[model samples]
Target: MSTKRKHEVPDQQEPKRKHVEEPDQQGFTRKNAEVPDLQELKKKQTEVPGQQEPVREKVLDHIYGNKFWGPYLSERQWCTVREETLGNCWDSTSYEKITHDSYRWGEDGIFGLSDEQQKLCMGLTLWNGKDSVVKERFFGLTGPQGNLGEDVKELYFYLDNDPDHRYMKALYLYPQTEFPYTDLIEQNKEGFCHSAGKGVFDDGHWQIIVEYTKPESDTILCRYTVTNISTGVQTLNLSPKFWFRHDHDAKHMTDVSCFQVKGDESVVSVSYQLEPDCCYATYKLEVKPGGEDIIEWELLPVGKPSYIDNSSDVIQEWKIKAETFYNSLYDCQWSDQEKAVAKGAWAGLLWNKQFYYYDVDELYHRGQAVENKVKTVKPGNWDVMERNIKWRKHFKAKDILSVPDKWEFPWFAAWDTCFQMIPFCRLDPDFAKHQLLLLLSERYMSPEGQLPGCEFNFDDNNPPIHAWTSLKVFQMTGETDLNFLFNSYCKLQKNYNWWMTNLQCSDKYIFYGGFLGLDNISVVDRGCPPEGYSIKQADATAWMALFALSMVQIGIELTRHNFPSPGDIQKDLIKYLKDFLCISHQLNKDIDNGGMWNLEMTFYNDVLVDQLTEQYIPIQVRSLVGLLPLVACGIVNFSGIRCTEELKQALQTDSIHVCDITCGTVNFSGIGCTEELKQAFQTDSIHVCGVIKVRSLVGLLPLVACGTVNFSGIGCTEELKQAFQTDSIHVCGVIKVRLLVALLPLVACSTVNFSGIGGTE
Candidate 1:
């Protein structure tokens, strides 16, 4: 039997018990419940009937205190500093020695350090009145049932003599309302949706506001404001503690030895010499009643620390930027809620941006692993000897902008980066434009003219959507910078050539791997090439067709600008357009001839063409592959076409035919378009294709492709109009569920803007 008192400070000798398996009030067993993955969380929302609910409603409920205390008044979400020991008993060094490595005794750790030594370290502590006896006690979640396990250590604070106490008191107190009043508002209107919670705290009614911001600079800003609310004179002493963990990068332990701390009447500063040419500084403000202070913390290369003196100016500059950003949104006719969501989305994008450095050798090894996987099915052909050689010779670890969820996906994906630019272009066009160039830069792009699929896997192929993204950004911004267009065209042309040379299965069709970002949606394993035959992917061919069309548009732009290469560009553009049209015609002919189209079923599916037999069989799955033709379809004005009149007429004829095929085959109604095509659609039976059954990127591709169809000329029936309205409502209900699908309904309808129905302006 072990002798250990509940809530008492744990000793090393205390026997550890196995984690209990008790189910909580929510029926989640503590031991068995794993943190849900993204897919599982999404599935829970769509599969469960009542799981989908507006987060705003829940936030409002918390504010009213109907369900629980509002997040503003609670410290549950706030991160806490904890004391942690690195090595276990199994290590060469004892656990006791590891704990004492950085530990200091008495005043030497506090006030005895020299000014030069103090310049390298910083700390935060809660100090009580000098008269009281100091009592040391530990406070943290420390049980099998508690949030944090027993092994984890936490930092403790001392006030006067009271060490075992909650020193941080943050609460919202509004006299007029029965419950505390709190509002989620943008901190800087000019900034990319920096959200701040505004509330009043304490009986004295000190206004407490917490705001977070991430500038283009590497540092993250967390600002707190406390304003005195009471008229009477009051005295309060509050100190927040901070401890720098030595375990962050053990390779930098010698650098950690250079850390020092210093304090004055109004400020406490900590500094660390990170490298021979790098230093980091952290400052905490000591503000009184009626005054506000900002703590400026940043890690920078070794230089004169001007940010310390200019912290106020840095904060003001961000404020000014935020103001400008807010004013831009104000100019647009958007609801407060819609604007809030947009801001939040922008904030998420900004917050998630990180500067990542990769080791070329490690990346090369990872790429080799990917190539080995491919070689299992298609030996010799999939070997990445050239890529490995290129990486070993030219690649060096350098910082790059990583714009994905750093925790889930640290590396950038070629096509995912294009989608990332969509939101970023709205916030910062320069950054977005630079991102497009970065992927095509000589450093990132291979000598073979291939843009790497991702950092880990170089051989995998993502869709060629960079040109499409570029065109959209250019059109949105009305940017006429010739350099951007010229450079983009040149890079995109090389990328196009690489794809045609390496991926083309036939003159018209292209092959793609599973890196297209739609996982497990195809009939045959797209990642695995068939043993003896080339696989023709409808999506891959369609993407290439779109890529070719983008190039043609770029060429036309160059010609309009009178660029030196316009004559050759125009000739090349004409050839690319002709190729696209031929591919479209071939796909249309294949559907008609290959028995892939079920006229009775009225659905077009992907066909698996057997290379040896010269025969094609239909892949019966109803997926995005069927809708890629629509994405490939684009219309050019008569003036834009530089091809011969005969070729131009043939292209137009093919376009209209492809449009008809796409519109007719995509069964919006679940009844499969047999009766629904001839008669009025049963309003109840008209289901959005892949809306409920398979919720994926593939399902949303139809809505993305909606812009290609000329809806006005389609001769819309009364039933079709009614179905559109009904489907829009359904989409609106689940708008908060998926970010990509949220914009679909708005993009689908061209004539009438759905502004009244929460569509983005």
Candidate 2:
């Protein structure tokens, strides 16, 4: 019996009771026992340190305020093809024209921020008292000026960023002396090293740390920490710029909204009817030797500068929240340095998002006019431009996209976007899904089911990885969003039809197209072969096989999820599975005629065919092109499906035959030599295919091919059993690789005791 205190209520009266342990018989408490406070337990379970759950919930609910502003600004807007009205892009635009001339497409600056549509933009400008012009945008070499192609000549680091764009930070170092703009171009032209005998960072530079914080959904705060790293005092002019783009839409609003400086040059306000009336307020701190000098700017409503009086407190509070947000993502055992590296890598990805805008119709007509001018001046000099600008009437891009680099390769590349979305799925799945859909949309994709490879060349065939990435994003996000799945499947089917119709040359089901984005990898230009001959591509065919399999997966999910549609989904699903088997069959068919596999080389290679003579020659180069076939391997588990006998029979084919053939070459990919393969096998030659055999990533590719199949619903047919046996042999052989033996033991204690291969003891 327990007696209650004055503050405690009766057990019957209370809705919930506290958890307590019963005492043991020896007049002692039980081991690991204590009375738990219900209120404290509830608080500990529900409360996160940074309260990022509410922000994430807001993101899920599609609250536009939380995502209204972000780092969607381009680092370099000049020298892009969208800005050029005539001639080549690099020759028409320069760094000098960025400040005075209004851009036709988009805006750019140093560490900038913009809205979703990029109508209103804000960026930072700097002057170190020695340069000829204000450092508005980053200065880099043109493609003709640099030996290693175009590159940025500035030093910048991305520090931190959140998924919701709530808090962002970056660092840009500016040299205090006169910038070596001309010397950098000339030195890069001469050789790799600078001819002026000076590196860019070899001189004394000023470290400027930039950060953006949003306390409220409508308010944005910016801080720039300018530190003097020179020996003596230096004068600096820093301006936080805010302007509307000089496009067709904003040209009318320019007369209505003008900048007004108030309160002794500390505040700049802009009033507009269409957009929210905003004001920028600044607060500066005194500078000292080896000390930090701060300049803060707040962008909010015209009347809402309440945080301006105590901006330091607001900045510190948001900084603590950002630190707490990142700290919650790590485990207690991870070191601080390891966490910082992971954070920096993610920050770089988030900062690379840029607003890409290009109208292909505008480019084509303008290019046609430019070509006429060139033909009149120097006849036959512009034939290439005239021929290349023919089939680009359907491409038009105006959206915020992830780029490889904002300074170099600013426009979106179809293949690069696939890899970029993999990381983006972890950061923001909604943005990832949107990015995947944008490429397949009608605005960018042609009516003939052709997706633009990039801005420079629309006709070039990038690897068909969009379906693979769509399925990846689906699996990574726990298979939610059925609408995204359905839409992706429908659009991808059209793109697949385009590939089959345009790329396949021979009835042998071989594929060859212009430049599958692997430039300079082959010995000869695969895009433009020596006129009369065509090269059969191994990678292109393998990618098509993977695309067929991905379509099968998406079709299976759509049928399984009970999506309400009138059409026969299962029939289409069966068609995709059959397509996969056919493509795989053709891939491993014959090496002498037009097949991809090379028997003497013991690898896959592109088959070069002579059109008139009907000759097939294998270009024996052991590169990634050979190993790409392994990525086409996957397992399809058809357990809970209600299908007809036709669909069931199609699923029971020998899907693992390619896996066995690729795995047989595992012995040839050895360190020095092994007796088991020599004793167990019979081959004609023992030539070494590669020097780093079985040590590089090529060795592990076979393991990806060995997927454990389970045909639970369909009866155990002979072909199914054969595939299982082949896969088991491939799996056992792959597990014997030395690198995998050391790794698999730490992850799982499974043994490879298949009937064909011996024990791993």
Estimate every model's Cα lDDT from 0 to 1.
0.41, 0.64
Cα RMSD for candidate 1? 21.9
- Give the per-residue lDDT digits (tens) of candidate 2, residues 394-477: 667778898988887788889899999997888889989999999999888888898888766677889999998998999999
Q: Which candidate is the best by lDDT?
A: 2
What TM-score does candidate 1 reach? 0.50
Model 2 Cα RMSD, Å? Answer: 19.3
- The backbone clash count of each candidate, in order, is 16, 0
The superposed Cα distance between candidate 2 and the true structure at residue 170, in angstroms, equals 0.3
At residue 456, what lDDT does model 2 achieve? 65
The candidate maximizing TM-score is: 2
User: 219 in model 2: Cα distance from truth in Å?
Assistant: 1.5
lDDT per residue (tens digit) for residues 692-726 in model 1 = 12122355566543322235555676776566565
Model 2: residues >4 Å from true position, as ranges? 1-64, 194-203, 249-288, 328-333, 363-393, 564-567, 652-761
